[model samples]
Target: MKIYDIPGFPNPLRIRIVLAEKQLASQVEFVKVDLPAAEHKQAAFLKINPTGTVPVLELDDGTRIAECTAITEYLDNLDGDPILTGKTARDKGVIHMMQKRAESELIDPVGIYFHHATAGLGDALREYKHPQWTARAEWGKLQGEKAVAGMRYFDSVLEAQPYVAGDAFSMADITVWAGLLFAHFARIDVPDDCNALRAWKERVDGRASVVNPA
Candidate 1:
């Protein structure tokens, strides 16, 4: 198996964490997806992933599966019963719910703010240029602010639990970890006042797999 990835990108990080947790890092090959020059927009990549998103999984038989969450689900359930994602129907329900909430509440806003709203990446995303999106740029900045508030709610959740959804570290934790790291890099304040969350982030960051891959 192979994984199309980009370091510093949250979505790809989610998949990488899953690989580490599953102890399957050595079983797959990782191909770096270059976003600076818009390599994902090139025809070669479009052939493999129409959406041009990173973290696409390539089966040995030459099939490709895109989207980070779906890829995480695939890897988690490989051993059967969807342990990390959810072992029971209720677990699956809450995990998926919380995961999506994090995306909508925190991660998506960052993407809109950093990539679409800011003119920082003038030449990096050549293909995304459009009059409509240009007009919507200001919204991204405001959305980023909202994302910070949403993340605080997450901080509160972490205050009560060792992980995102509950005691056991699950996919939700990976999603939050990856997204928060990106926010940190983007100069977003993670509210140092959230003592519990601050501590949790430190612990999660200590995972060797995140700092070094197999």
Candidate 2:
């Protein structure tokens, strides 16, 4: 299988981290897209994913899989492994619930505030390039602050558990890790009160798959 990735981007990195966690690194071929060049916007690239996002998986049989969540779920269903996404209905529900919260409350809002207010993808992504919004930096900053509150809530949940969905390190953890890692890169501050989250984050970061993928 072939996977298209962008090293610095959060979406691709999410899958990369999961690939490491699953020990599937060596099993897949990686194709890196030049994000700064806006290569993803080209028609050739769009054929694989109409959305033109990175971390697209192309099976040897010519089937294409895109979106980080879907890709991770696909990996979970394949080969019947450790069941990170969950082997039971209750586990799946919990994992998906946490995933939903992390994505909706933290990930989406933070990215939106950053891109729209800070002109994050202005140079590479044409759609979000509106200088008028940059002038509303304060408003965007407030949105970021709101996002941080959600992070705190998420942190509280993670503090008591080994992973997002309780004791198991599932795709929900991967999703949260990718978002928080990207938020750190984006220069957002993590609250000092979140000791559990901090500790958990370190544990996840220290895994061999995350640190030195095969």
Candidate 3:
């Protein structure tokens, strides 16, 4: 199998952590994608993923998988002993629910704000990521506020549970962790009062996979 992504990027890091958790790092070859250079938007890369995103997974037989959730689902189940996703129906439901929340409420907003409101990735990728919209910066600022609200929402959720989905750590936790990471990069500070979220981040940061991902 081969994974295409830029290292240290938030979305890619999510899959790398999954690979580490599944102990599948050694089984895959990594192909670097030059995100800042707009390599993903080029014709060659678009053939693999029309969405033009990084962290795409290519199976040995030539099947390509895009999106972090899809890649994670494949990797987690490869050994027939899925841990990160979930083992039970209820767990799967909750994990997917929270995972969607993590993406929609937190990470997605931060990304919009980063690319539109700020000079994201410099001039090389600006034209592709940020178009000529008069109100884009204002719209991005609103999304940034939404992301902050998301942090507070997650903080409240964490105050009631050990993990995002429930007792056990799952893909939802990874999504939330990555969302927070992107939030940090976008300069969207978690509210000072979000103690539970901060504590959860500290705990997640100590995990072996997060500490040393693929």
Candidate 4:
């Protein structure tokens, strides 16, 4: 299998962590994509993923998979144990719910704010961002506000449970972790009062996969 991605990027890092967790790093070859150069938006890259995103997985037989969630689901299940996703119906439902929340509430907002409100990835990528929305810095600022609110919400959730979904660490936790990472990059700091979220971050940071991902 081959993974097309830029190393150290938040979305790609999520899958790399999954690979480390599942011990599948050795089984895959990673091809770096120059995100800052807008390589993903080019015609060649678009053929593999019309959405023009990085961290796409290509199976040996030529099947291509896009989106972090979908790639994670495939990698997690490949070993049969499915530790990152979930083994039970209830776990699966909760994990997916929290994963969606992590993206919608946190990561996605940070991305919007980063790309629109700031000079994201420099001039090469500027043309690809929504032309109508590019000048609307105010809207991007609002998204940054939403991301802060998301941090508070996740803090509350963490106060009541060991992980995002529940007791065990799952894909939801990875998404949340990466969301916080993206937030940091976008200069959206977690609130000082969000102790639980801060604590949870420290714990997750110590994990082997997070510290040394694929």
Candidate 5:
């Protein structure tokens, strides 16, 4: 299998963590996609993923899987036991719910703020960007505000529980972690009162699966 992604980017980091957790890092070859050069939008890369997104997984036989969640689902189930995603129907439901919330409320907003509000990857990538950049930039700032609210919400959730989806370290937690990471990249500040979320991040950041990827 081959993984196409831009190193250090949030979405790719999610998959790298999953690969480390699943102990499958050795089984796959990572192919770097140059985002700064706008390689993803080029025809050669678009043929693999029309969406022009990174962290795409190509199976040995040439089947390509895009999107973080879909790729995660495939890798998690490849083993006899699933960890990050959950094993039971209820677990799946809750984890998926929380994961989507993390993306919609936090990660996506941070990404919007970074790309639309700020000069993202410079002029070479402008053609691949959304039209009406000025208006979108104003809108992106609002989304950054929403992401701040999301931080408070997740902080409250962490105050009552150890992890995002209850006691276990799941993909929901990973999404939030990646969101915070994106926040750092985008210059979004975490609420000073959100102590629980800050501490949770410290714990998650220490995991061997995260600290030292296979």
Candidate 6:
């Protein structure tokens, strides 16, 4: 299997964390997709993911999977233990719910702010951006605000629990961590009052799975 992604990008980083957690790093080859060079928009690359996104997984048999959530689902379910996503029906439902919330409330909004309000990946990716990006400065700023709100929401979540989805580290935690990382790149700081969230990140950062990715 091959994982095609640009290193350090938030979405790719999410899957990288998943690979580390699942201990599947050695099972797959990593293929670098040079986003700055606009390689993702090229016809050959688009053949794999018409949406032109990174963090795509291509199986040895030529099966292709895209989207960080879907890729994480595949990786998490590859074995019987099911650590990241969940182990039981209720756990699965809650983890999936929180994961989607993390994406919708935090990750996606920050991405919108980066691609629309900011200069994005410079002129190289301009042709590939959505047409609405041209006139969405105000909307993108709103998204930035929404990202902050999302952070506060998660801060409250952490205040009550050790992790995003109850006691165990799961995909929801990965999504929020990725969102915070993207927030850092986009100059959106976590609020000073959100100490719970800040401490949660500190714990997540110290994990071997995150610090020493294969």
Query: Any idea what lDDT model 5 has?
Result: 0.92
lDDT of 1 by residue, 1-214 (tens): 9998886677888887788778888889889988877888789999989887687999899978998788888888777756578888888888998899778888777766777666645586845654577566767778789889878989889878898888877888788887787777666778768787788888888977676644
Clashing pairs in 1: none
Greater-TM-score candidate between 1 and 3: 3
- Flag clash pairs in model 5: none
Give the alpha carbon lDDT tens digit for every residue of 1-214 in model 4. 9999999889999999999999999999999999999999999999999999888999999999999999999999986899988898998998999999999999889988988898888899988987876456888899999999999999999999999999999988998899999889989899999999999999999999999999
Q: Which 10 consecutive residues of model 5 have the lowest summed lDDT? A: 120-129
lDDT computed for candidate 4: 0.93
TM-score of each prediction: 0.90, 0.88, 0.98, 0.98, 0.97, 0.96
- TM-score of candidate 2 versus the correct structure, residues matched by position: 0.88
True-structure Cα RMSD, model 2: 2.3
Clashes of each: 0, 0, 0, 0, 0, 0
Error of 6 at 64 (Å): 0.5
The candidates, ranked best first by TM-score, are 3, 4, 5, 6, 1, 2
lDDT string for model 3 (45-155, tens) is 999999988889999899999999999999999989999888999888888999999999998899899988988787888878656665889889999999999999999
lDDT of 2 by residue, 1-214 (tens): 8999877677787788777777788889889887667788889999989886788999989999998778888876777864667888899889889888878877766776776666566576755244565555766677688778877987889767778899888877777777787677667778888887788889988877667643
Clashing pairs in 4: none
Model 6 superposed RMSD (Cα): 1.2
Preferred candidate (lDDT higher): 4 or 5: 4
* Candidate 6 worst ten-residue window by lDDT: 126-135
Stretches off by above 4 angstroms in model 2 are: 126-142
**Which candidate model has the greater TM-score, 3 or 5?**
3
The true-versus-predicted C-alpha distance at residue 128 of model 2, in Å, is: 5.1
- Output the better candidate (2/4) by lDDT: 4
Query: TM-score of model 1 relative to the true fold?
Result: 0.90
Which lDDT tens digits does candidate 6 get at residues 76-104?
A: 88887789988889999999999999999
List the global CA lDDT of all models.
0.80, 0.78, 0.93, 0.93, 0.92, 0.92
